[model samples]
Target chain A: MSLALSLAPLAYVACPECDLLLNPVVPEPGDKAYCPRCGYLLQRPRKRSIERTLALSLTGLILIVPANLLPMVGIKIFGNSQDGNLWTGVSALFKEDMWAVAVLVLLSSVLLPLVNLGLAFLIGFHLFMHKANNQLARWMHWYEHLNEWAMLEVYALGIIVACVKLAGMAELRFGLGLFAFIGLLIVNAMLSNELDCYFFWQRIAQLTKK
Target chain B: MLKKPLKTAFMQGFIRCHDCGSLLKSDPKCLCPVCGHHVSARKPNSVQYTLALIISALCLYIPANIFPIMSVTQLGVAETHTIVGGIVALIQSDMVPIALLVLIASILVPLMKLLGLSLLLLCVHYRWQVNARLFTRLYRVIAFVGRWSMLDIFMISILVALVDLRGVAQVIAGPAATAFAGVVVLTMLAAKSFDPRLIWDHQLSYE
Candidate 1:
């Protein structure tokens, strides 16, 4: 039986060598399964994944600060320049009576990631201490819940598409916020990797001396 | 030619015992022309569950395509388009990669999932001989990826909410959001409805 079979309900397997979480694959009888990288038997993630996730998430949270504080996309149409970050766009949407869309964007891009980061922090902290905290499990559950809603990459895609559409009509300007946004994405990806549930669970086990 | 009346003939010959060529009455059950064994047959539920999911998926497919996904607005100009239109816009704007992605995620993938689930369901329902295990595994893979189609929808929603600068430029969402959401929800339901036991109908049940 594969390690995935043991831990599947909690988390998926990330190949230690490649860091790619392998999707389910059929195993042949007597086949010695190993990580796609380094040809070593792939088990669960390491204890440090939670720390890494927390560290990256904290960095992401910090980056998010500047990412929002700075202007995102700048429009210089007819020599009049105006730049808007996420909050501005959200406020604009609300003012225009597109309340539902405003709420969706706000929740998906901002609120959800924040909640995910918070959950990752708590989950990682508890696992590191090797304490069986019910709150940690609850937080982990909440993190999982938030992961799907925070579609930052999708939001980014929408930004690019909107930029393309606006090219002929407006003098579009990329601002510092765009760079920050890219940093947010990279940090978010890294955070997601670091906070993998498998690593947390393993760390918890080790702490418990189980 | 005259035909004679046929008479039913009773077995007059007797069975001979190996010891003495002695005759014995024949047994009622067919004990040994050679040998006898009882045969059993029953199908599994996973097959039926898988089939139900597929059918429901097909039911949602038509609505998913026929419905408009989003409406675009600029300078008092408004136009509605289906999933395909969005992809075309991306392509025309030299965002070919994103365009291909949108096409695959929003259009092709959902259709494939619907079709794949349907095939798996039908095979299980009919006890049709095929790779039951493979189908079961494929079902899981499809279910796992079913949510990713939301990428396009999420993008549209974000844009609609964010780009309302008024008089200069503004964007609004159309009726398509609900329809797209319906597609996602319905497909997910279909994937969930499929049962895995149908795969063993022929092999496990009969044994």
Candidate 2:
């Protein structure tokens, strides 16, 4: 045990799940290293992660404008038609004197996601340009923190549920923005799952060193 | 200290960076050289923060469940439904899968997360020597499944956006939507604040 501890720090990695210290072999491309005791994925570097994430991020960012600007749902009641988009939803909540709810909706549904996607694009762009400065590294760290709070997928699921419930009561017509929002959600999910921060950071480190 | 020593990175004066998987020499004041994230032996005040967050979530859970999550209006008639009421309404309408989804995502998951987190906190506090593995697994499950509770909140947002006929039919988000969102967010914070290392801390004590 003492001999193992005496080895170089780089030789060991602790399992985040079980806290079991194990020396893991660096897996070749397409392979993964898992926590021996608890099966938690320790490390798995994806091929072309940055490029793929950048493409997905750009797609998500493009969809956000349509998702918020264009009408998400069209409601026809008693031969009168009204189309509501994401921004109108916030205004409606405000009109009802639910300012707190309005703010929450605006933040979770719109602002947070926009900021996250924007940051992702900036980071991807900077890294692609080989501008590995401390500022970009700091932005990468901020991006990690922002990733958890940007709940676009959750919001998408909620929209689906709301659509289903509303279908029974009113003549619900799907709008173009709805599809764009769904596409945004899918692209964001793909971006998140594929982007490996470790590899990205490692690449940044190498570039900065150069 | 008669029992055999367990081989751990902590015991070896090293801590693993949570974000980058880099092993670094333990230094409370230092950041991980690889990822530039703050490295700590364990999350500072993890239990206290988690306990406080969980208590606040528990306080919010009542209102989240009791009040209507959202209201639907059609033809000059308005109907409000609480969390359970919403699920029951869906079930009544024969939308069993969606009903189950709402039930599990909004109601059951949050309640279970609170209970699970509280149990883990208790286990760590009392230094319970039984089933450490099970407790660790419970923590993992709570951490993972807690985020999905936001599904109901998301659904409410969508409903409010899509259903707007002015006079014929409209959907307005209720007070419960905010409270429910609070519960979900708080529980997620609670899970984040909790240090699973505390569970292992007791193992050394037992030795």
Candidate 3:
């Protein structure tokens, strides 16, 4: 309930890698702390962590609309032009009875990134305003776990692979959505990089505990 | 079995919550104060789950490569392509860079992950006295590259969606697409279930 209580507790840190208990290094903003025993990245406290995460997640949220809904690429084959949007890929898999891959694509490419961005935005927005939300801790927990599954960058590469494979068969045209999808990928990458777990957890623990 | 080290948190009555990274009293039944998630000293059945998943992926590895991933029909002619076949076609068509990309993502990465996790499992099972640090590095690499294997599955999905002009040209998912997706997911889970701490434990002298 005091001002100093907002700081992260540094009693000890167990490396997620080797579980070697050591005195936690309280890195300054923009500095990183690494595990002494197993070289796991212990912490990286970035400057303006909350604000930057909020901005990037907001940008990603906006881009998601155009990225997934609009046609990402158009193919011209023998005077026949067909456009492929993100949803069509999942639906196409389902049509071919590849439901497993369909769900995987849906979960990893579309749904998980949406969840990650939404959770991050919620967490970041509330934290920036210094507002108390009971769900902040839960949001942060899921955010960390689901971050790995949000594979926008990998899907971007998949888009590249798809274009490469089809280039000889058809004339490929880059659509506005492809650029927006790339923007979303870049924003998500930046947001993931900018996230400071130790700082956010400390802030949440401080906010909710009182 | 190696003697438990006194320096680590597990032996010193502190269990870090994997979810929120909070250091707490070492109790198997306690939920994390911040996240309300179970706190464990290590991933339960780490070696067994990793070994089982890796073996399962290896089994799927065969069908994933042999079965055609996609069948493309253009102008009343149909040709099926397995993963290797697709890469070879790409190479023959002077697309070596894309061929290499597919070769790496579809075949090499999964093979490396399966082998690396198996070696780590063997190391922990035998308590192999080797450089724990290097093995830990290997574990990190396996974990990082696990997601990229999905590159092929996503490509097929896009191809299936983009090339749907009936009779003129169409690409339909083959049986291998499902199995290939399985290999990627299982290997990722295998890597996740493994505890790198087990590697460092072998460095401790037997009591």
Q: Which candidate is the best by DockQ?
A: 3
**How well does model 2 score by local distance difference test?**
0.78
TM-score of 2: 0.89
**How big is the positional error of residue A166 in model 3, measured in Å on the Cα after superposition?**
1.5
Most accurate candidate by TM-score: 3
Q: Write the per-residue lDDT of candidate 1 for residues A1-210, one digit (tens) a residue.
A: 333245434223333212223433334332335534223343334335655776787788788877778888876655556677777656755665656556766777778877776777776667656566544534654676567667677667767766765676678777898899889988887787555454454444334344
lDDT, candidate 2, A1-210, per-residue tens: 232233233466677765677875555556787665555676776767777778888998899999988887887667777787778777877877777777877887899889988888887887777676666667777788767777777777777777788777668888898899888888888888888776676566565555
Number of clashing residue pairs, candidate 3:
0
DockQ of 3: 0.51
**TM-score of the second chain in each model?**
0.67, 0.91, 0.93
DockQ for every prediction shown: 0.07, 0.44, 0.51
Residue B69, candidate 1: C-alpha displacement in angstroms: 4.1
Candidate 2 residue runs with Cα over 4 Å from true position: A1-9, A208-210, B1-6, B18-21, B34-37, B165-168, B204-207
Clashes of each: 9, 2, 0
User: What lDDT does each candidate get?
Assistant: 0.58, 0.78, 0.87
RMSD of each: 17.8, 5.0, 3.4
